[model samples]
Target chain A: MNVPLDPKTLVAEMSPVSTSEHIAAMKKALLKNIQRSAYVYRVDCGGCNGCEIEIFSSITPVFDAERFGIKVVASPRHADILLFTGAVTRAMRMPGLRAYEAAPDPKIVVSYGACGCTGGIFHDLYCVWGGTDNIVPVDVYIPGCPPTPAATIHGFAVALGLLEQKLKAETHVEAAGETAALPHPDIPYALRVRLEREARRMAGYRQGRDIAEEFMALLEGRAHTPGSFTLLECMMEAIAEERDPRRAEIIGHLAEVVQQAIRGEAPRGETP
Target chain B: MLKLLKEIFRTGEATVKYPFAPMPVCKDFRGKPEHKAEDCIACAACTVACPANAIGMETDTAAGSRTWSIDYGRCVFCGRCEESCPTSAIRLSDDFELAVGSKADLTRKAVFTLADCACCGKPFAPAKEVDYVARLLSQSARSAEEADRLRLTASTCPACKRAQDVHHIADMGIARQMTQELETTP
Candidate 1:
């Protein structure tokens, strides 16, 4: 039953003074966080620059990460976090490693973009040095071909929390180090339950599975029959169209080809 | 130690369920490669800009043109190709979970097609490129005197013609898609 809305009764039940004090303390902590500041330096061994452009925009007026006391420094010495972009190339390995080392003690490394995560599409190129994991001790891995600005910001926030937790335990605070292992969303039940003799495993559903198989089939032409569309002809169409370069909707343009190929209705060789 | 164990027990476990449940990437996290075909002008800007040489392109001269091939194995995810793209035909996205069993299975391709010229039976490019350089010629040539200049006798070879045809249709499509990459969308 709903109780009558009364400030006096609400205070009596809620412990208003204690609640107010707790809020004040939390506010004070948040303000303190903003004052201390955190420095992040971005390193681009060799990248397409799309990721770099986003990184540039993040520090701009609109996405100003400085509001959260996070600033991108140009030099590694002043940085608390090392932001690495692109796939680490043969030439870049030394510099990237040096950059990580220069970031001072209590430093963390955050590899941004899929290239940094696993060398991305360039996984086995001649010059590729693999992912950042091959080179140094990485505290956090931010996966994406090139992470969006919001994701970059949020990742840094998560890194900041990790830093705090790491430090708390360093001085003998004795907190659980693996708390991040099980995220909240993965757990569906509101209440905890004891496990039986055997735990049940649910079935799994996948999204990229079908599309990936279809794409691979088209690329290899493993499913193509005689007189069917050739991979070369498809490649020809892509090259010719790209020459005009609208450069605006490239992703959508690619999607169309992917869709057409998946349907097996892609235009055959040529119409004379 | 007892307090530490109690706090850990109280919070329960935080392991992400695999296959069935995956961790959500942060907002703006770059993941997979997504193409904006409408904005792409069928230009090979992204291909030319790629440092890892992951992007491969082919152009069919007569019917349709412009094709892009991405060899993920060769892609460095440096994103240089996306940035240097004069038409901004390519972009790196926020998808990271792109693992496959066969290494050869990860190559991706994209395409664009263009219409041909009705009068000359040649593909000059999309009508948008020159807004029908050939069509305007056709209309003005109604008079015998103007017919000489109006007639387009240009016979591009098979390879060149196919390339032109693809660009003709693709320009309109790419123009729509690469706007963000180009940064000049009206």
Candidate 2:
């Protein structure tokens, strides 16, 4: 039997926690002379539990984060690293702060997943504080919807100064006379549109676009060659060469679309 | 103890050599969205399609520039940007290692010049986008005159096009009324 804490007593206005100069100096010193294993404690504020699953997976036998002496502890009091996951909700903000305070001095705070990094898709939510850094100081940010096991390990390594951060801020400016090239200039735009639409209707968006591009490339290659072989023959040859039945069927359907365009006939399911 | 040791030897190692050796990801892994600014038209399609508002565009009309930005921290790696991109410019690449020490390092930006409208001389759209549309229309035009007209239409802003449409409709109405009057008199 446990007594629940009163919500009124827990709800109080407090400023963001700040580390003093001594704590900063101690953290730097700890990073430099750290010889022992770093224990991690996961403090989930208001995550969807996707980050938690990945975190657990990272410590499993397959990823084995324990190989680097990183252990997930049950209590923040025993933690050297605090892995914060979630977009800090108003309700959980106090508990999150308490966990941060519970952790000893010279603690490394690693913000895990996209939500923890910048509140992810829930950034604009009414009750969300946007990110973990909005409340507590974050040493590193591991950005992904739910970071893979490898990414989690990499983030830990970055937090412990075992590896350098790979991403850097970059800005690209448009050069003088810069222009985007038209895709498939040789193919008729109407025909290209029809082919793309039919492919997308048959397959999914991404796969359909890929298929349409491949078909156009083949058509362009054939047009460039000095052969008298008709486009139908070329398509038939392509269909015959394709090993995957599903891909072959899609290509066949696209070829039918091309044929319909060539014959000047309106596609099916529409009144001319 | 001997039997347990034998079982452990038979089971072998299950751990992966990650952070040292390259980890192989699946083919359809939704990783980082790589933006090719060179190929991008800055049409704001990705910005509009982004569910998390991770992709954004800021149009500076006074400066005649449009800045496109994506915050990897806010990005959910949903591939919506890749799907909505018309130019095939933004794509989801297989690079998922996006940990950073600073928040600023998680942002990527591209600045594109804006095109002045042919009629109003105002910065209306990205120069690359206008140029791409004009070329695409010209390529599809049946005749030289049609191609020229289509090119002009692409370069004109929407407000100017609407104004031209109103004038053209008024002229047609006057012509039709005069023709009806002449026919009735005869």
Candidate 3:
């Protein structure tokens, strides 16, 4: 019983199941007015289980996903919504497809977590298909490393039509004569670099940049009115106002560095 | 039964009023990466720093434009892009609701014009980046001549800069030294 198999047919065979017009219309109706409880079946293709933990947490007492009539079911047979929670791996492709097929028609497919949406950090891996949409048509995409319980709830809300999706695709084109303005035109570039380097060395990049910006603002204020107040006096005032001891110490250190720069002396803590 | 009812009442409702009311997020909550395109120099720092390859850039030399794009669906909310940004063009905002109905809706893009090389007519880097660097160097420059030199250096392409370096080295009579070494070799 040898049947001749066409190469083109084999290639086309791997494509995702196409929805019929009846099923599409039914899905539209389901999305429009889904009054009953939506049973969700989580399909873990090849995840690290971080998304699973978040999903369970969303169902917990504090988050209470059941309050919205959303329940996690054991089998796809009982599911009205399929929650795909991993980057679709080569090994799990058949299983993922099986779960999708097991679920009833007009079922909503949700691409959950960063992995499920677009494979997250593992997008370029050899075995991965990059996203759930590669294997199944996704009705909703909930992106996060592993979304928080609240974020998960919001995603469910969007999926169920209870809430609207906030993010819209945006494209910004450079207009004629549009230019990025200099951050601090008044401050010397060298001094700004030194100050930013010192601040970043003390605090982390995020906090360091913030502290550097604040210190530069203070320096600029003093520079604007040299006769009004001394730079040291202004620094002392800033230090006094700061509640955090560590931050105050960093600010003091930055002030000393500024003072050394002003006096034409090499930076204090570095080897000459 | 009364004690149970009293206990339930005392506990209160544990569910959050999300979707209906605004949810309060903690300080430094890494949710959605917001890009202030106006401040961005199109340096591709975020694209390089992004762990998920969510941030990407495409340069069309023919079009004389560079397009910067981010697929939120692929972003892991790691904050690496925010950290690596020199001008604070990109930062993680508190907005977390990123669910989308369409795949295309999950992407955001920005287009920037490319600057032509001072030596060659070909487009090289982003205009904003070259302008920003030129301005930064000029700010630190000691004299007007030095500022002009810095501006020229910033605007020139790498190939032309290399060519200039080679020409300068050639003018230094390095070939004479090479011949001298060859004659002196035992």
Best by lDDT: 2
Candidate 2 chain B, run of 10 with poorest lDDT: B12-21
Q: Whole-model lDDT, candidate 2?
A: 0.93
Model 3 misses residue B88 by how many Å?
A: 0.8
Error of model 1, residue B23, in angstroms? 18
Output the lDDT of residue A194, model 3. Answer: 87
Off by over 4 Å in 2: A1-15, B1-7
Residue-by-residue lDDT tens digits, candidate 1, A122-237: 67777776567667655455554566565466556656652221111001111222111111122111111101000111111111222222233444453345666665466455
Highest-scoring model, TM-score: 2
**Which wins on DockQ, candidate 1 or candidate 2?**
2
> What level of docking quality does candidate 3 show?
medium
TM per model? 0.33, 0.95, 0.92
DockQ values, each candidate: 0.03, 0.85, 0.74
Alpha carbon lDDT at B131, candidate 3: 92
TM-score of chain A, every prediction, order shown? 0.48, 0.93, 0.92
TM-score of 3: 0.92
Predicted candidate 2 versus true structure: per-residue lDDT over B1-186, tens digit per residue: 999999999999888888889999997788989999999999999999999999999999999999999999999988988888888999998898999999999999999999999999998999999999999999988999999999999999999999999999999999999999999995
Greater-lDDT candidate between 1 and 3: 3
The window of 10 residues in a row where model 2 chain A has the poorest summed lDDT is: A1-10
Candidate 1 lDDT over B15-117, as tens digits, reads 4332224446565343454555544444566777776666766767564655666665445566566545433345666554443322334466655544465
| Candidate 3: regions farther than 4 A off | A1-13, A225-227, A268-272, B1-4, B174-186
